[model samples]
Target chain A: MLETAVFVIRRDLLLAMRRRSDVLTVLLFFVIVVSLFPLGVGPEPALLRTIAPGVIWVAALLASMLALSRVFAQDYADGTLEQMLLSASPLSVIVAGKVLAHWLMTGLPLVLLAPVLALQFDVPQNFLGELMLSLLLGTPALSLIGTIGAALTLGLRGGGALVALLVLPLYIPVLIIGAGALDAAAAGLGAGAHLLLLGAFLVMAAAFAPWVAAVALRIALE
Target chain B: MLEAIDLQCTRGERTLFSGLDFRLRGGELLRIAGANGSGKTSLLRLLCGLLAPAGGSVRWHGEDIRRLREEYWGRLVYIGHANAIKDDLTAAENLAIACALGGHRVAAGALRSALDQLGIGGSEHRPARVLSQGQRRRVALARLALSEHSPLWILDEPFTALDARAVDIVQEMIASHVARGAAVVYTTHVELEIAVAVALRIDLGAAAV
Candidate 1:
């Protein structure tokens, strides 16, 4: 199982490396959308600081959503999904590997890039740690749950929009807790409870989402 | 043994086939022959445990394949109608990933030779998107060489985009696999000059009501 998971991760990373433009596009989208909010909402430092948590979290959500539809699209298009289903390893194991790889490719970048983007909103140095922590804890859940949506919408016409519709509702809890953590920190309150809840959500999603996605992938293939 | 007993398939209220039974043992080649829309692909999918039959069961070694699951799948290799090649990866990279996924960790030299045998030798480092349809098909077919340890092969129209020379290469590979006592179940509309003595042919068109 470990071998299969590692093989999958290596393969996906290699593919992502070959297609660097896709990864760059997602990063640029996150950066651009977050940058545009300061322009739209006016350049009041107080206002930008007040809205930083929500604005950054929302942009991260949209950036991750932009990548969700592609989680299974390439594999399904080329019939690799069928081959994956037929492998000796359990389908859920493969799904878990793919989800982990997806997070590594899409989610981790967002987490790493968030601090730099947050500085644009004049977020204080103290709260930046909390923001990054919340993202680090919350984005895996996004990738995991988004995988279920991706599997459910695989091969459908206009699936990109449909995947966002299916996944954004599920993402609300992560967004709330993630942004709420930063908000609590900025207000001089400890973010422990919110961070703990985000951790709980991650645990729940990690435990269940891969199996659900695997079943959904089978249905899509059928 | 691979067996399908009274297997019935219905796609969206349309019955594709009913009361289907067949057995494929080692050293046997079962060619599932049918015209388009005749459930040839469906039956292959069922045999690979990709789709559940509406009735009956597909069995391996007298155990239901669904129950056998990974153990059954471990010994079988199925190449569907679509060549599962990634456009961004080179032929060598594609083959390596495919082989790895299929539980075969082939060496780099072995991968190159396999692609060479399939007539894509010199182009192994080029992205699959740059390859012609026949070359891409050959990349997918390269799995046949690496899959020698697997006992059963389920190929769905393995010759679709191949030219005459490539077709002959694939046919020869299939024939030799059967000679080595590995069972083969394939669906093809093209007539193949395989060197097997009386390869079993199941015409799904005639079997369908």
Candidate 2:
């Protein structure tokens, strides 16, 4: 099982590396969207600082969603998904590996880019760490939960839009807590509680999302 | 051994097949012959435990496959209508990933040889998207060359996009596999040239529920 998971991760990462443009598009989308917020809202430092956490978190959510739609679609189109379901390893194990790969491809980049984007918003140096930390914890949950939506909508017409509709509602708690942590930090309040809650969400999502996604994939294949 | 007892299948409001019964033991080959929309693919899926039969059960070695699950899948190699090839990846990369997912981590050298055997030699580095349909199908069929140890092979339309030469290559592979005491269950509209001793052909058009 472990070997299968590692193989899947390696395969997906290799595929992503070969198709460098897809990854770049998601990264550029995140950067562009975050940058546009400042231009649209004007250069009022206090205003940008106050809105930084929410704007960045929302952009991360959208960027991850864009990546999530392709998570299973390509595999489904090529019949790799059926082969995956038939593998010797349990379906949930493969699903978990794919979700982990998705996080690495999409979520991790946003977390890495958050600090740079946060700096553009003039977020305090001390609070920048909180923004990155909150994203680091929360984005995995987004990827995990978003995978369920991606699987549910696999192969459907207009699936990309439908996935966002199904998943954005589920993302509210993570977004609220992730952004709230940075806001609390900026207000001299301890961000620990929000960060801990985000971590808890990650744990919950990691435990159950793969199994749900597996079931959804089976339905989609049928 | 693989056996299906009174297998029934329904999609939406239509019943595809019912009371389907068959058995495949060592050194046997069962051909599921059917017209389009006659549930050939569904039966293959049911045998592999990908789709649940509305009635009855499928068993491997006398144990229900649903209970055996991974143990059963570990010994089975299934290739469906979709070649499962990634367009962005090379032929060699596609084979490596497919073999790995099927619990067989083939070495680069082995992958190249397998592709070569399937008549796709020296094109391992080209992305699958650039390959012709016949070449792509050969890449998918090359899994058979790497999967000699698996006990059962479930293939759906393995000859769809193949040229005459490729078709003969596939037939030779299947014949050799059955000659070696392994079992094969496949769906094909065209007649297979396999010469196994215990060949059974069921035409689904006449066996509909």
Candidate 3:
């Protein structure tokens, strides 16, 4: 299992390196999205600060989903998915490795880049830490759930739209808690409950989503 | 040995095939011959554990394959119609990654020799997508040389888009694999000269009304 995970991680990283443009585009999209929100809403520091949590979290979610599309889609298209399915490693390990790779490529960058965007929104220096933490816990859940979308939409017509449609609804609870945590921190209230809720969501999603994704992949393969 | 007992499959409202039984022994090759949409691929998928057998079971070494799915899969390598090569990776890198996923290690020298033998030497460093269809097929076939662990090879349309020389190379490779006590099940519509005689044949004709 560890061997499988390491192999997948290496493959994912190598692919991302080879396609440097796609990864850069994801980060660029995130920046463009955060920048657009302030422009559309007008650059009132107070209003931007007030809405910063929602804006940043929403952009992060969308940016991460964009990154998610490349996750299993490339493998599925090339028939690597079938090889993985036939591999000795359990599907759970393959899915877990894939989700981790997705997070590294998508969620980790988003979290790491959040501080810069948070500054753009004039978010309180004190709340920046909480915002990052909320995202750190919440984004894994997003990747886990989005995997099912990636799996189900494998080989489907117009898979891009199908993945977005299937994944966005499932993302609502995580977004609610993720953005709420930052909001509570900014308001000088306890954000622990929201963070805990986000953690719980991540746990459940990590445990269950891979199995669902594996089954969905099997169906798609058939 | 690999055996399927009363295997049945249905695609939605249509029954693709049912009560399918076949056995493949070590050092033997099974050719699954069928026209397009005759469920040849579907049956291969079922036997491979990619698709579940609706009403029967696949057994390996007298144990139900489902109960031992991981072990059974560990021994089998299935290459589908789509040559699973990543167009972005070089032939060597592609074959190396496949070896890792297939749970074996292929030394770089071995991969090079294999690719070279398969007539991909000039473009082993080039991205596979830029290669011709026959070249891509060679890259896919290069995977068979990456491992000595797997004993069963299930290939779908193993001959699609291959030149005569390429076809002969692949046929010899399969022959060598079987001669080494490995079992192979490959799907191909083309008739060709194989170095070894096929041990069993399963041809699916038009479904009875």
Candidate 4:
């Protein structure tokens, strides 16, 4: 079963590698969104610093969600999901592997890209590490939770906007604590409490979201 | 061997079929005959455990399929009407991927040889997306020859898009697999053109409740 999960993750990663443009667009969107922030809100260093963490986290959330639609949608469209269903592996494991792969392509890149975006916002050098950390821990939860919305809207015509509608409400807590963690660092207070809360959310999502997504997938496929 | 006992399947409020019993044993090929919307694909999906039956049971080796799903699935290979091959991958890559997904490993040379047997050697390197429909079907059929672990093969419309030569090759492969003690369940609108001595036919038209 674990082997099948690993195989799925490996297969998607290989597919992503071959279709490099898909992942590239997410990065470009990240850059464009971050660049737009400075242009839209004037280049005031202090103002950019004040809003840097929140802006980056929001962009990461939306970008990750954008990238995630293609995750199961492609497999579902191509009949791979049906084959996966027929395989010996449990559906939850398949969902977990897919969520993990979505994180690798979507969340990991967003985390790695956050620091550069943070710099553009003129965030203090002292707070860059904290910003990146918050994103790394928070983005997986975003991907994990985002999958539920993706699964729910799997075959819906206007799935993209519907995914945003379904996920943003569920994403509020993570967004609050994630930005709070970085804000605490900037304010010279301990960010540990917020980061711990973020980790807790990750644990909770990792435990339940895949099962929910699996059930949703079964419905969508049916 | 695979068998469905008094199986009843329904979708929504509509009962698709009822009291359908069929069996495919080692060294035997069974054909599922039905008209369009006669629940042929649904029946295949149910038999492979992709969908649940509203009533009755599916058994493999005398054990309920749901109870022994892993063992049953490990021994079965199903290729539906969709072809189920990733277009981005080459013909050889698609077969290797399928073999891997089925929990069996095939060496590169052996995989090439299998593709060669299906007369797909010349296009092995090209992406399957570019292959003609007949070639793609041949690529999927090639997996049956390469994987040893999947003893029972369930194919839906296995000859949907194939040339005369390709169809002949597929029939030969099915016959050989059955001769090697692997049970086969397949559906085809068109009749099997080749002369196989005997086959059990379950016409869904007559089996309808």
Candidate 5:
């Protein structure tokens, strides 16, 4: 069963590798959105610093959502989703494998790119580490939770918009907790509790989101 | 190997089938026959646990298939309307991954042989997207060649978009599998004749069976 999950991850990663543009699209969106914020809001150092956490977190949220449809839309269209459901392994394992691959393709880039983009907002040197750390902790949760919306909205006429509607509301606590981590660090608080909370969200989302998404995929296919 | 007890199916507001019952055992062959939208594909989906019946239960070896999800699924092969091939991957890669996911063990050279037997032998190296509609269906049907040990095979429109020779090859594959004590269930518009000893048909569109 673990072998099946590994195979799914490898297969999806191979697909992503073949379509490099898809992976780059999400990363570039994160970069471009963050870059525009500094321009739209103007680069006053204190003001930029004040809105930096919120702007970056929101961009990450939207970027992750933009990539969410890729998680299942292609497979669902090509009928691989049916094969995945009928696999000898449990659906949850396959969902986890796909979710993990999605994070590596879409989520990991955002985490890796967040701190560099933070400099655009004139974020202080000391706060850069916290911005990256907060995203690193929170992005996987975004991918994990985003998959449920992807599954629920699968095959809908306007599933992409529906995914944003269904999942953005679910992302509230993540936004609060992730942005709070950076705010804490900027205030001379160690960011320990908020970081821990983000980790907790990752863990909790990891445990339940795959199972929920698997069930949704099953019903959607049915 | 499989049984449907008073199965009922509904697609949205319409009931496609109800009071559907059948028994299929190892070494037997059953074909589902129906007109379009008469629930031929729905019955196939229900048999494989892809669609839950609106009523009753589908069982394998006396246990509800829902409870025996992986256990039942691992022992069976199902090829639905979609080929499930990755257009970006070679035919070989597509076959290899599908076999692995279906829990069928493939030897080093078996993937090539499976494609070979299906007449797509050397084309295995080419990506599936370049394959014609018939060739793509051949690639999907190649799975039947590799999964000989699976006791049950459920196929929906297995003959769709295939040439006459390809159809014959698939029919022979099904006959050989059934001869080896593996049960087979399929739905197709094409009339089929198999050399196998046991053959049955469920005419789903004629009336609720």
Candidate 6:
């Protein structure tokens, strides 16, 4: 099972490498969205600092959701999805691998870029670690939850927009807890509570999302 | 070692077929025959555990396939009408990955030789994007050439786009697989062109009983 997961992750990463632009588009969207906040709010350092976590977390949420469609769409289009369902590996394991690869491509970039983007808003340098920590814990949960929406909307007309609509509601909990972690840290309270909640969300999403998404995929294919 | 006992299928409000029965023991060839809208593809998908029947059950070695699930899938190779090739990967990479996904880790050399047998030998380095439609189908079909250990092969419209030479080559491959005591269930619009002595044929137009 682990071999199949690694094989799928390797193959999807190789696919991402060959089509570099798709991966870059999500990263650029996160950067551009986070960057737009300070300009729109003018040059108030205090205001930017206060809003930084919300802005960065929301941007990361959107960026991660942006690439969720690609997770299964190509495979569905070309008949590979059927083969995936029929693989000797359980469908859920293969899905977990695909989701992991997607997070690596789309979610990890947002986490890496958040501290830099937050610094642009003049968020206190001391709080940068908390901002990065919040996004790092939060984005995988975002990707995991986003994949359920993606799988449900697969092959629908207007699926890309539909993914955003279906997923944004589910994303709220992650957004709240993730941004709260930074707010807690910025206020001199420890971020441990919110970070632990985000970690729990990741565990729950990790435990349930792949199997649920796999079930959704089988229904779609049928 | 496969049996469909009184199976029924429906698409939306229309009933495609029902009370369909057949038994495909090892070393047998079962042909699924029907016109365009007659549910041949649905039946193929049903047999391979991709779709649940409206009624009845499909069994492998006398156990329900739904219960068997991945274990059942491990014993078969299914090629649908869609080619399933990725556009960016080279033919060799595509072939090797497909085998790996099917739980078979075929060596790069063995995969290359299978492509050779299918007559696309030297073009293995070219991405599937550059391969013609027929060549891409051959790449999907190449899974068959490497899948002798799998006992059941279900192919949907396997001959649709092939040129004559490729068609003959695939027929020969199927014949050899049957010769090795495996089973094949296939659908084709082409009229009984297979030289292999078929054990059974199900024409969905005349579906029931």
The best candidate by TM-score is 6
- lDDT of candidates 1 onward, in order: 0.91, 0.92, 0.86, 0.84, 0.91, 0.90
Model 3 lDDT per residue over B1-209, tens place: 89999998887777878899988888898988877878888888888888888788888998888789778888888878888888788888888877777777678788899899888877878998798988988888888766545789998988899998988888888888988899998888897656665568898876533
**Tens-digit lDDT string for candidate 3 (A123-189):** 8789988988999999889999999999988888898888999999999999999999988998899
DockQ values per model: 0.80, 0.84, 0.74, 0.53, 0.81, 0.84
Winner by DockQ between candidate 6 and candidate 5: 6
Worst 10 residues of 6 chain A by lDDT: A110-119
Residue pairs with clashing backbones, model 1: none
Candidate 4 docking classification: medium
The deviation in Å at residue B166 for candidate 3 is 2.0
RMSD of each: 1.5, 1.5, 2.0, 2.1, 1.6, 1.6
| Selected candidate, larger DockQ, 3 vs 5 | 5
Comparison by DockQ, 2 against 5, better one: 2
Shift of residue B149 alpha carbon in model 4, Å:
3.5
Candidate 5, residues A1-222: lDDT per residue as tens digits?
A: 988899899999998998899999999998999899778987688999999999999999999999999899999888888888889999999999999999999988898888888888887899988888888989999999999999999999999889999999999999999999888998898788999999999999999999999999999988
What lDDT is obtained when candidate 5 is compared to the true structure?
0.91
Model 6 clash pairs are none
Ranking according to lDDT, highest score first: 2, 1, 5, 6, 3, 4
- Tens-digit lDDT track of model 1 for A1-222: 668878998888988998989889999999999999988989899999999999999998999888888789999989998999998888899899999998899889999999999888898999888988999999899999999999999999999889988999999999999999999999999899999999999999999999999999999998
Give all TM-scores, in the order shown: 0.97, 0.97, 0.94, 0.94, 0.97, 0.98
Model 5 chain A poorest 10 in a row by lDDT: A37-46
Give the per-residue Cα lDDT of candidate 5 at B157: 92
**What is the Cα-based lDDT of residue A16 in candidate 3?**
83
iRMS (Å) per candidate: 0.8, 0.9, 1.0, 1.6, 0.8, 0.7
Residue A158 in model 3: lDDT: 91
Superposed model 2: Cα runs more than 4 Å off: B206-209
Q: Which residue pairs collide in model 5, if any?
A: B1-B25
What C-alpha lDDT does candidate 2 achieve relative to the native structure?
A: 0.92
Candidate 6 residue spans exceeding 4 A from truth: B206-209
lDDT of 1 by residue, B1-209 (tens): 99999999989878999899988889999999887888999999999999999999999989999999889988999998888899989999999888877876889999999999998899999999999998999999999998988899999999999999999999999999998999999988898768885489998775344
